[model samples]
Target: MQPVDLNPKRKKENPLVWIFEPLERDPEYSRERFFNFQAAYLDGLLYLAVASGEEPWNGLVVCTSHDRQAGLLEAFPVLAPHPVLGKWLYVSQRDPEFETVAHQMVKLARERDPRMGVVPGKRKRSPDVIEMKSSSRKKKSW
Candidate 1:
């Protein structure tokens, strides 16, 4: 994982960026774990986007609180591309507007990226089978 550039002076700073640095520093942290979590999260978000035809990031809530919100917002701008996902990070700060924005974002993403909205078809099932048992004992040979 890359170091999160938290310098506010940078034109493209993201609020969530700070979390990356700390997560990276953890001794137990592993690339496989990180990627696994990232893929799962992204996949779920993508699934939601495809189902609702909306942008997944728009659903994020930044957790309202003067200090917390500011810190996160300053570090992770909604418009900035995510380091791992390479997509804009949406910030809501626990506001009700998050759902609306997220839904819209999903829609926009589907429109912009064809691959993002394509859901795979379900697999086919085998036909059911049944066997009949002899109701009566076979007639004694004549």
Candidate 2:
């Protein structure tokens, strides 16, 4: 039996990491795991993500504002509005032009295209979870 390398450094990288290589060359570029996806950011603005999961989410998520959607769509018709999250556009990995569009997006991002990214929204805690935390902090009366 082969022993798996328990060393964290040797862990397999995300398969889609290469698609964002253009932006990775910049000092401001950053990457993080968002939910089940791999999100790429430039100067803290999320530009795109590699979502390799179930259907709708199994592709690239181009994080742009509504006003810019039309232009991106016009430029790359292979992309479309995400089924569940209509606000963001998506390019399915199953699409034939996925690789081409991915490269083009990375190029635009590398050039610091104004329409490529958005200021990520802060994640809000659930009301019930906050209430539970507050209750736990209080001294219990018998």
Q: Which candidate number maximizes lDDT?
A: 2
Which segments of model 1 are wrong by more than 4 Å? Answer: 1-87, 113-142
Error of 2 at 28 (Å): 0.4
**Residue-level lDDT tens digits of model 2 in 15-89:** 887888777679999998877778999989998999777789888999887888998889888989889878788
Per TM-score, the best of the predicted structures is: 2
**Worst ten in a row by lDDT for model 2:** 8-17
| Candidate 2, residue 5: lDDT | 83
Per residue, candidate 1 scores C-alpha lDDT tens digits across 8-126 of 77644233332323234434332222211221112223222111113433224211223223443453345333333433243333445544545543444333332232222344544
Alpha-carbon lDDT of model 2: 0.86
Give the distance in Å from residue 125's predicted Cα in candidate 1 to where it truly belongs. Answer: 39
Stretch of 10 with least lDDT, candidate 1: 32-41
Off by over 4 Å in 2: 1-13, 135-142
Q: Backbone clashes per model, in order?
A: 12, 0
